[model samples]
Target: MIPQPTPAAPPRPARILIVDDSAVMRALLRSVVSSDSRLEVAGTASDGASALRVIDSVRPDLILLDVEMPVMDGLSTLRQIRARPTRIPVIMCSSLTQRGAQVTIEALASGASDYVAKPTGQPSREAAVQALAQDLVPKILALTALGSPSHGSARGHASAFPLSSPAAPPRTPVTANLAFSTPPQQPPSGFAPAAVLIGVSTGGPAALDLLLPGLPAAFPLPILIVQHMPELFTKHLAERLDSRCPLRVHEAAEGEPVRPGHIYIAKGDWHMEVSAHSAMPDHHSSSAPVLRLTRQAPENHCRPSVDVLFRTAAAVYSGRLLGVILTGMGHDGLAGSRILRQHGGVLLAQDEPTSAVWGMPGAVAQAGLANRILPLNAIASEILRLSARSQREAPDLRETDPREAGASGIGWVTP
Candidate 1:
C-alpha cells in the first residue's frame, strides 16, 4: 500500500525585540506583536542598553526601538546596532510630539530603518490597539516580510507589502502580473519640465539626505515632495533638510505660490495640491499656481499622497512637469505617475539597489511608467542635465522665465 505524503511544516513566526522605557508601552507593544500570527515577541527591554544586552541571545528578526529612553537613548543605541556586523532592521516607536518627531527623524537618518507614531489621542485602549495594529503591524510585516509567501530565510526575507506613501493613502494592491505587464517605454524627446514633483516613503528621510544636498542652489524648476510622515515630523524634516540644502526647503504652507529654486514638502496630515490663484479683476487672466493643503481622504492609505500632488501638477504644468518616484513601501505614486505620463510629463524612478524598500519606485518601473530608472547618486545630475536641456532646447516652452513670473506675479500658460 502507498503511504500518504507528509505535509510541510508551517514557517516560523518572525521574532521581534521591543525596547521602550515604559512597562505599559512594552506590554501594549507585546500585545500588538502577538496579535499577528506572523509575528511574535522574542524579548522586551526597558531601554536601549538593556536591549543590546539581550539582542545577541534573542536573535530577533526585527527591533522596535523607542526614541527616548532612561539610560541609553535610541540614537546612541542605534549607532551601536548599525556598527554591528549583522544587519537587523530597527523601527523607532516615537510619540506624536514635536521632540519625538525630531528624534525619530534623526534616528531614521542615523540608520534606523523606519518609525511608527505612538498612539497619543486614542479614546480607549482598544482604539489605540486597533490603530497600532493598523500602522505598526503593516510596517512590521513589510519590513520583515514575514507576511509574504515569497519570504524564505531570515537573511533573505522578501517584502510582503506593495508600493505606497505617508499620511498619504492606503495602497492599492496590483497583482505582480499586472504591475509588470508593460515593457519599458522610451521617454518623450525634446521635452522640458517647468517643475519637479517627487514622491518617497519608508527610507525617504535618509534617501533625501543623499539626494537633496546634491542639487545646486540654482536649480531652475520648482520642486515639490511628498514624504510619508506625520505633521510635526514633516516640519522637523523640512528644517533638517533646509539646513543641509542650498535650495530652500519648506514644509509647504497653504496659499504659497510654487517658485523655482525652492523645495516644498507636503505637510503631514494634509494633501498638498496646486490651484491657480484667483483670476485678476477682469477675470481673463490668473496669477501663479499656489499650494492648497487639504484633509481629503487618504489615497493608498496616506494623506499627503503622491497621487494627489502628481494629478494636480499634471493639470497645472501639463506636458511640462517632471515626476520622480523614489524609494517607498507601496505604490502610492504609481497611479499619479500614470496621470503625469498621460499629460505628457516625464517620469523617473529610483532603481532598486539604492532603495531601502523598492515598493513604490519598483511599481513604477514594473508598470513601464518610468522614462529612466536611475540610482540615487545619478538622479541629481540627471535633473541638472534635463534642466539645462529645457533652457537650451525648449525655448518655446520657456516663454516666461520662472524668475520673471515670480517678479511679475504671472503663472504658467498651460502650454
Candidate 2:
C-alpha cells in the first residue's frame, strides 16, 4: 500500500495586545479577538506603563491602543512605543470628536498603523467592538507578513507622507478659461453636475498637505470638507491649512456663510449643512445668504460624518455639486455619493494605490458611484480645471479677491 500523504501544518495565529483603561473595553476586545480562530489576545493592559511591561513578556504581533486613558494617553503611549523603537504595529482606538480626531491624527503621525472610532452608545459600542476586530485582524496579519526588518525602515520616511509644507504667499490668479461641454459619453442613468465636495480620512493630512496648497485662492466654487477627526484636531487642521493654502480656511461655525474662495470644514461634533435660507434683507434691502450647523445624531457612526455633509450638499447643490471621497476605513461615504450621483453631482474618488487604507473610497468606486477615480496628485488639477470651466459658464459675480478676502478678518491665527 502507498504511504499516506503528509498534511501541511496550519498557519500560526496572530498575537495581539489589548490596551485600554476600561476593564469593559479589554473584555470586549478579548471576546472579539477570540471569536476569530486566526487571532489571539496575547495580553492586556490598562495603561501605557503596564502596556510597556506586558509587551516585554508577550511580544505581541500587534497592539490595539486606546487614545484616552489614565496615566498615559494614547499619543504619549504611541510616542513611548516609537521611542523604544518596538517593531510592533499599533492601531489607535479613538472617539469621533474633534479632540479625539486630532489626537488620533497625531498618533498616526507618531507611528500608529491606523485608527478606528470608538463606539458612541451601548448598542453602537457593541457594533464598534465587532467592527474593530474585523478591521484589525487583517492589518495585524499584514504587519506580521511585512516582518520586523521592514518595520523600522517603514518609519524612517514618516515625514515623507506630506502632512504639512512651508507656506508660500498667494500667487496671482491664473487667467486660463476652460469651457464646459457634456461629453458624448455621459454618466450612466444619473445626471452629472459641475461642482464637487470632498471627504478624507487617515492619510488625509498628508494628502491635503499636497492638494490644498496647490489650489489657487481664487478657486471659483465653494468647497465643503468633512475630514474624520476629533474636535481639537479639526481646529488644528483649519489653522494649519489656512497658513498653507491661498484660499480662506475656517472651522465651520453655526450660521456662518459658505462662499467661493473659501473652504469650510465640519466642526468636530456638529453636522454642517449647505442650505439656501430665504435671504434676509440687508441695510441696502438686498438679500444675504446664510449657512447653518446642526447638533444632529451622528451619521455613519460619526458626527460631522462625511456621508451627512456630502448628502446634504448633494440635495441642495445637485447638478452643481461635485463629490470626492478620499482614503479612509469603512463605508461611511458610499451612500452619500450614490445620492450625489442620482442628483447630477460629479463624483471623484481617490484611487486605492494612493489611499492609506483604501477601504472607504474603494467602496464607492467599486459600487460605480464615482465618475472619475484619480490618484492624489491629479485631484487638485482636476478641481482647478472644473472650477475654471464653471466660472466661464456662470461668470459668478460673487467672486471675491482672495488676497483682499484673506485680509478681511477671514484669516485669523488660532492660539
TM-score, per-candidate, Cα-based: 0.84, 0.63
Per-residue lDDT tens digits for candidate 1, residues 63-123, read 9999999899999998888766556778999988888989998888766778998888889
Off by over 4 Å in 2: 1-12, 17-38, 42-61, 65-89, 93-103, 109-113, 116-195, 230-233, 278-289, 393-415
Best by TM-score: 1
lDDT of 2: 0.66
Q: Candidates' lDDT values, in order?
A: 0.79, 0.66
The stretch of ten residues in a row with the least summed lDDT in candidate 2 is 171-180
Q: Model 1's lDDT to the true fold? A: 0.79
| Candidate 2: clashing residue pairs, number | 15
Q: What is the lDDT of residue 220 in candidate 1?
A: 62
